[model samples]
Target: MRWSHAALNCGDLDTTEKFYTTWFGARRVNEFDLGDLRIVFLRLGDAYLELFGQARPPAGETPGGDGHPVAGTVRHIAFQTDDLDGFLRRIEGQAEITLGPLDFSAHIHGWRSVWLRDPDGVIVEVSEGYRDRA
Candidate 1:
């Protein structure tokens, strides 16, 4: 089976949608409003990312805190790019680079990766040269 979309809880739907669209070239595919919550789906090629926003978040749960550095149910989300250098250049001063543009040549062939945080502190990993052994 192929992979599908990943969903995220966003504090601000507009900001989160803009972030994905501007940096990853994602386009809006669908949206839903359910009185107290809003959902938006964005497409990047076949893959999709879902954004969920709530008007009133449940107690003890902080909105837009999904990308915390600490370990949790989901630590981070990753994306692969063909032009790593160009992508980095595009995001300059726009997004926060939390970790490397490090080489993983020895461990994983020619893979190179960098990590960053989204608007809500969610860690995102971008890499290149990953060989899918499917």
Candidate 2:
């Protein structure tokens, strides 16, 4: 079966929506108010991300941490791009670049990637030449 969509529990829907749209070119396709929870669906090319927000504010810390994954962790959300350099330039000063725009050619043939953190500190990876590597 093919992949459908991924969901994220966001603290602020507007901020999260702007982040994805501004950097990754995601467009809001639909939204719903489900009594206790509110959700917005964003379409990025063929894929989708559902952003969920609760009526009550978050009680404690978010699910993931900065470095090193614990068991059963869903490390990061990755996106592929044709022009990595141009995308990097577009996002300058918009968010923090947490990790490399480094080369992965040694391990993955022609692959190169970079990592950035969203407003809520969720890791987002952007890569190029993944099809060749795959």
Task: Tell me the deviation in Å of residue 117 in model 2.
Answer: 0.5
- Looking at candidate 1, the ten consecutive residues that score lowest on lDDT are 61-70
Off by over 4 Å in 1: 55-72
The lDDT of each candidate is 0.82, 0.81
Cα lDDT tens digits for candidate 1, 1-134: 88889998887888989999999999999999998889999999889999998534434532232244445657679889999999999999998887788898887788998888877656888999988665
Across 43-82, the per-residue lDDT of candidate 2 in tens digits comes to 9978899999753454555433333375775678999998
TM-score of 1: 0.83
Q: 73 in model 2: Cα distance from truth in Å?
A: 1.9
Q: Candidate 1: global Cα-lDDT?
A: 0.82
**Model 2 compared with the native: what TM-score?**
0.85
